[model samples]
Target: METRTVVAECIGTAMLVLFGVGSLVLAGDYINALGISLAFGFTLIAIAYAFGRISGCHINPAITLGVLLAKRIDIRRAATYWVAQLVGGIIGAAILFLLAKQVPRLQTAGAFGTNGYGGRSPVGLGAGGAFLAEVLLTFLLVFVFLTVTQKVALVGVEPIPVGLAYTAVNLIGIPLTWASVNPARSLGPALFAGGGALSQLWLFLVAPMVGGVLAAVVHRFTHQRPVGQAQQEQAAEPPRVGPWGRMRGGHRPEAGGPEAKGPEAA
Candidate 1:
């Protein structure tokens, strides 16, 4: 509930949509899909390093949901982050829309970098294909995020893998559904684009959330619990007595023993 954290999330999400979607809205003709994809990836890397300490730089509602489901953050914090991120995204898109309007002959009404399928899709992918593509693409991003941010992961280098995973998903997803792995990112531009973008918005929102949930479920099965969490869980359990009356299950290692030293002892 820290005010600064919420502000950071809002500012971070705004920067993401501004730079990532702005690259497309303003410079898609020059930079093309690869450049746009890199824009999104690089923006994420910068946000992660800059605000990762304060807010973890979720920026994306789907990512926040994944973190929440993983129990990394409580519901109150997650809801706060979601609101901040959505507001930030809309603010960013609004800024982009104004900038685009300044450019001569630039169109911001129909597309405006909004995600879509069917005719709006680069490859004309159908609704079902787009939904599946978004789910799988978002799954990869969320899964990488969950795995790389773990206690076992190398500190100070999580952004590299996460950004790279984002770039990879975008590379494959752009032609299909414009790579809407983040619902906040998609909703922002769609609000401005209106028309078909509004109608098709449901798929982008629902698919990413489903993917986040799946990522959390799979992450639980794949990664071991942090040592401190395991210890806490053990401490909370009632102690049991064996046949000989020795403490079992919830017993803690004797003080100064090797077992009592935890992972640091290794």
Candidate 2:
């Protein structure tokens, strides 16, 4: 694995939490829910463009898991990304925590932008409702990401749909469970919020992973691969491309296979 790729994942995931979650923690009262949703969407778009070339800019562990299941990236690489994203999320949350402390009378204890259910939920959504909501919400986000990135024709415009999908999920999920399509996003804030947030953290993590798996399975059936292509993709070293230029690793090559023109070739 390349060091730069890992670093990019770390930085990109940190930025996602810092700006996306930060908007809710710092400015939720002023910006409101829609603004917070936009914050996350906008941050994802920025990260996709900024680090897309280097790491495919997954940032979220759920996305990485989906990508791994799709055979886009190997398990070792996925594991590395997961670690990087978790660390980055914590780092971003720690920074957000410090900043929140600076504001007088600002509360960061119970909420801190963490996902939850029951009394912690905004609409009083129960545990079962929260779980189902997260699964469906995350399914939409991951499904969009997989669909957009897989098509060779949609290379440059991938971020738009993926980011919008994220925004859409947040819009619906905020009232239910504060929208935890990304586990790293939830874990970061919960660690600092402690107490109930920690207890409720499992749903955020497990549901997203389930959603990711479901997306991958559905994608396989929906987007059928060419006969023999699966074996080739598994055997050969796949080409890499920036998010704008070509499908990321584990995607069909631009021309067809490994010999297809890549970012460097272009």
Candidate 3:
């Protein structure tokens, strides 16, 4: 299970960065942000649905950590997921590097589609705004995730809800944080951007986790079931065993055998 989850994260994040940054490499002079934001949103749900049964395919450390605190995952497994996400991001960027090398302008910069802040922002947004944007965007994503994976999970049409919620997150966050919401998503781009992107990378990592933690805490306290759940559980069982020992507990006497006092007839 552990190994499969790690493989899933690595593969999923790879696909995410590949298509996501690849879209950027191919972006025209103007519509880069719009196109890339859409890729990021849709790719999130695509990967989650594909590997969700395996690793829950978070593809984002902040999401993974939030789930961990909500008691959805153990620490060891969460650590593995984070490593897989980061490594996958790098590998994705490396492959993008190889592919973009064939292009003209992209070859020089190897525009593997990097992330940035301050003077580097695509829209010229500042660092402080970017950090806040990341925190809120990732928070909304993790919160939406928490809703879908609940046991006795919601009925049909569940995936659409989570997917659309992610899309909505993108709609709001794109201008400011470039709609990162996922650490590995930003990390890969920052690695290629280097310099300021690398420096501001800390904000991308820290803010999301902070928001995720806060959302988790609030969700936990507010989403508790009524104490009557115990009564509802008790009401579901059938009547107890008659002359037989406790319904499911003690062993029953063997028929026509020693315990039944008829062994000689055999």
TM-score of each: 0.84, 0.84, 0.77
Worst 10 residues of 1 by lDDT: 250-259
Question: What is the C-alpha local distance difference test score of each model?
Answer: 0.88, 0.87, 0.71
Q: What are the RMSDs of all candidates, in order?
A: 8.1, 11.6, 8.2
Q: Name the runs in model 1 displaced over 4 angstroms.
A: 151-155, 225-266
Clashing pairs in 1: none
Tens-digit lDDT track of model 3 for 8-120:
88998998888776776656345555666676667766776677777776777887888888887789888988999999988887787677777776542422455456666
Q: Give the per-residue lDDT of model 2 (tens digit) for 1-266.
A: 78998998888888899899999999999999999999999999988888877888888898889889888888999999999999999998999999999999998887899999999999999999998898888888888888888631223778899999999998998888899989899999999999999999999999998999999889888986868998998889655675655556634455555534569654
Any runs in candidate 2 off by more than 4 Å, and if so which? 151-155, 229-266
Runs of candidate 3 exceeding 4 Å displacement: 28-32, 107-112, 151-157, 226-266
Q: Each candidate: how many clashes?
A: 0, 1, 1
Question: Please, what's the RMSD in Å of model 1?
Answer: 8.1
Task: Please give, for residues 17-124, the per-residue lDDT of candidate 1 as tens digits.
Answer: 999999989999999989999999999998888888888888888888989988888999999999999999999999988889999999888899999999999999
Question: Residue 188 lDDT in model 3?
Answer: 82
